[model samples]
Target: MDLTVIWAAIIALGLFMYIALDGFDLGIGIIFPFFPDDSERDLMMHSVAPVWDGNETWLVLGGAALYGAFPAVYSIVLSSLYLPISFMLVCLIFRGVSFEVRGKANRTKNLWNLSFILGSAGATFFQGVVLGAYLQGIPVKNGVFFGDAFFWVTPFSFFTGMGLLITYSLLGASFLVIKTEGDLQRRMHGLIWPLTLVLIGFILVVTLWTPMTDPHAASRWFDSPARFLLYPVPILVIVVATFMFNAMRHQHDSMAFLLTIILVFLGYIGLLFSIWPYAIPGAITLWDAAAPRSSQVFLLVGAVVIIPIIIAYTTAGYWIFRGKAEASTHY
Candidate 1:
């Protein structure tokens, strides 16, 4: 296999880690507006506070890998996604700061809370928009970006943003059900069904729309060889979703959460499969956008040494902090 393909897989893995790790915390932020009670919010904040910063490490790794291994892809994406990415970064800044500032400000606790919620929701929405834009396609000409600055701003993109908000809320609620107890757990349980339904609706829409909108994607799944590869994906998704619902119904909170994560993972695998060989989704192939082989080799060297360390760090951190969070458990 080419170094380009190897690096692409690495970056994809990193992105998935970021989504599965930081995603629930971002989901927590998205659901912040629903719970008006200060004590409940505190518990929610405490649930994510210990690990939020570390969770973002995967994002940095993913971006860095993309930039180092495929400068052309990075440049094109940076140009096309400049505005939304900038806004997302600002939201992340506020969201991160709110975690630190919330505990310190007695008088302005509400303000910080608002910051956290808006930042989380805003960042999550824009991220979905970015994903939508990629699904639709990034306009490029001969390996160069040619789309307008606001090309990502579209009806489909906004629809995706809304869908992600619901999806994250579902994830956040499921996580709370696992990490909390009593009234909070019950409240999350009550919210899970509707959120699960909404997420399923979004998934259905994307599943249908993705194949219909892109001929390449359609053939990738429906054609013979790739078809065999992908045929089980939807079936697996259905099974996982069903299991999640059954677990939720039985108040198996941990099982429900695990199934939800599996469901998301299956969806991600399907997406990556549909867009295989393309880094920018129908625009740039992995080889075409790859940087020099020397650069890839250099980066691969560091990645080989550093990636394991990061994995160890993340695993140890989670292991150390594994327990149900309480309202008094402030970072």
Candidate 2:
């Protein structure tokens, strides 16, 4: 395989892993506030606590690969996405702090809960904006992300943020099904049908709007043979979503959550397929943005050593903690 292609695949795989792994944790954070009581919320938080921090390993790896393998794309994306990224990072910091402080604090479960909700919502919104901005394309010229603070501002970004908020919340709810039982499980299963509908609405609106929002992307989707092949992505999303809805309605939370996750995964793949060569979509192709092969190979050795260690530790931690979560004080 070509080095550039190989490197691109690594980046994509890393990103997919980030979404699949960190996704449910982020979903847990998003859904934290939605549960009816503090105990249920605590259960949700505990389920993710063991692996949540380690889940970020994929992000770190992806960032490293982007910097090492595709420097130019990294520069453009980071430049354009700086504000949202900063906001998201701050929310993450506060959220992580809340996790520790809540355990230590003698009182004020209310305050900690507030922190958790705000942190989750803020992080999720920023992530959505970043996705929207990436798809909509930044106003870059001659290798710059342009100057306006509003460069990333748009209606599409707004919808994207909302969509992901629902999407991840559903993911969290799905997890609740898998991890909890009794009243909590019933409530979580209650979430599936409505959330599934909302997600569908989001997809419909985005599909209609992306054309008007980014014609270049619209061209790729609306144009001939490419367009025809692309239909299956949305079809799969719909099919999986429908199946999840049925499962959830029937009280099969585990299967419901798993299938919903599969839907999101396919949607992610579709997004990647839509813009394969361009790291920044309309900005730089992977090869043009690629670093030297020697550097990538050097990093690959370190990655091989590091990634497995992280995975093993993460797996072990989860296994140690695994079971129906019961609400309690800090870890």
Using all chains and alpha carbons, the TM-scores for the candidates as numbered come to: 0.97, 0.93
By summed lDDT, the worst window of 10 consecutive residues in model 1 runs over: 223-232
**Global CA lDDT of candidate 2, please?**
0.79
Candidate 1 lDDT, 120-188, residue by residue in tens: 999999999998888889999987889899999987788888988887787888899888999889989
**Residues 1-331 of candidate 2: C-alpha lDDT, one tens digit per residue:** 5888887888787877777777777888777766657667777888787777887888888888888888888888888789998998999888888877776565787788778778878888888999998888777778667767777888889789989888888778887788889988898888878888898788778878877766667777777466777788877877887787679768984798688768787777667766766777777777777888898788778878887887788789878877777677356
The deviation in Å at residue 189 for candidate 1 is 1.5
**Evaluated with TM-score, which candidate comes out highest?**
1
Q: Give Cα distance to truth, residue 229, candidate 2, Å.
A: 3.5
The lDDT for every candidate, in the order shown, is 0.88, 0.79
